[model samples]
Target: MTTTPAVRILAIGGSTRPQSSSELALNVAAMAAQAAGAEVISITGRALMFPIYDTETTHRDPLALDFVEKVRTAHGILIASPGYHGGISGMMKNALDYIEDLREHDPSYLDGRSVGCISVAYGWQATVSTLHQLRQVVHALRGWPTPLGGTVNASVTKFDADGSCQDTGAAEQLAIIGRQVVEFAQMRQASTDATAPSANSGS
Candidate 1:
């Protein structure tokens, strides 16, 4: 009997600051995706620090190239961002801009992939707005946004040093988002595989 390969879920986000709440929240979600049987790859903190995205640059930064490669192969994605001025932080936005490199890929820009999004901010206003913005970005990229997106109000909720969320409800919701992404990715993969021509069948 053969087992199915684990789906690859890439988690990316967070600001420049160390151990940020947004990063911690992303970790929590990534953990949940792992629990749901995905092979999770997290690109956070210093890994996110790359030259700002420019469409006309002849020389591409190594780190930027690495980031693009990960996105190209990931079956799904989970993004967590800190709210800045009622939207996503500049760092997170810049990282996402690197995805433009995939424009020439076969499926292009996250097409046929599930994206789980979360936004962390001091208040509900920023959290909601940032989450909405994230979903909009996912839609523009042609990715499927999970049914449940998370809005974490950091003013009242807290995350532990070990990347665990302190608010039970918030934690559960984030986990649900992660699981949903993994589930959708698996379904999509299975569908694609089923539709492909068999090796033994001659074209």
Candidate 2:
């Protein structure tokens, strides 16, 4: 009997400030992914600190390399970005640019991976626009965007330092995003395994 390996779901993004609401939101989503039985990898705070992406240069800082490797092997992804100027924060966007490194991988740039996107901002406009931009980026990466994306309005909602979300609706929505990513990843993995050749098959 062969048991499938646990799905790896990489969660990335958050504001540069430590323990910001955006980061807390990301944590909530990751927790849900864990509860759903996927192993979660987080790239937040200083872990997301890297030099600007340069397509002309092959040289990459250690942080950039690490981010690329995680994305390369992840079965699913969750990204929670702080909304800046009605779009994603520069820090988060820079980290996302590193995904170009996966273009040479066997599956190529997030292909067949499910991505859950979240946007935390002070206003509805920023949150909604940021979420829209994130979904567009997921499509561009060849990843499937979960049916439900989380748009958290910080003006009306708050995440406590103790990792508790003040808004029940927001918390539930974020969890749904996480669960959906895991579910999609599981389905895709099962499909791939079913089509794989048996070890005992003769050439």
Candidate 3:
């Protein structure tokens, strides 16, 4: 019989700006995930002491090491980033580079894991691109990206001062994505548990 693992979701906001749109989007997503019965942890990429990824320091960054450990233990992930020049911001991209350590430490860090992406941008053009890029990054990690990976246009003023999305329509969509991620992660976890061999039962 399949049993579900406790669904632990880790969310990262791409930008570290004081009033970053990425962080705002992540908070909204986190609220929706909490409503869906998942245990969620939010990381600002600020806690870690990672250095910029360079060929020389790639293997020895403490922050990178810490991040890999965190992701390897989580059942699911949600990422929100801001668009910068038609791509993701430098901080988000740098944080993602830390995932490289996981490939060696746990080649399956993302395998069978569920992931969702959200992006906030000044305009729609960069929003979609940033979201797409985030999804691609998750895919490369071997994680399954949810169908509703999102894009939010900050210009719409859809988000409130507290980083909550105030617009009903946009909020609903983001919530749906969060719910989908939790549902998918739970199912995947259950399936993995069911497939593992029992220690006492070779019968």
> How much is 77 displaced in model 3, in angstroms?
0.6
Ranking by TM-score: 2, 1, 3
Clashes of each: 0, 0, 0
Worst 10 residues of 1 by lDDT: 55-64
lDDT of each: 0.93, 0.92, 0.79
Off by over 4 Å in 2: none
lDDT of 3 by residue, 1-203 (tens): 75444699888775656777777778778788888888998887465336776656546666666677778888888888889999988878877777766666544658777888988899999999988898988888788999898888989846677777778787887888888889998887777778878777976
Show the lowest summed lDDT stretch of 10 residues, model 3.
45-54
lDDT of 1 by residue, 1-203 (tens): 55789999999988778779888889889999999999999999778888888878857888888888999999999999999999998888888988888998999999999999999999999999999999999999999999999999999999888778779999999999999999999999899989989777988
Candidate 3 TM-score over all chains jointly: 0.89
Between which residue pairs do clashes occur in model 1?
Answer: none
Model 2 whole-model lDDT (C-alpha atoms): 0.92
Evaluated against the true structure, the overall lDDT of model 3 is 0.79
Q: Which stretches of candidate 1 lie over 4 Å from their true place?
A: none
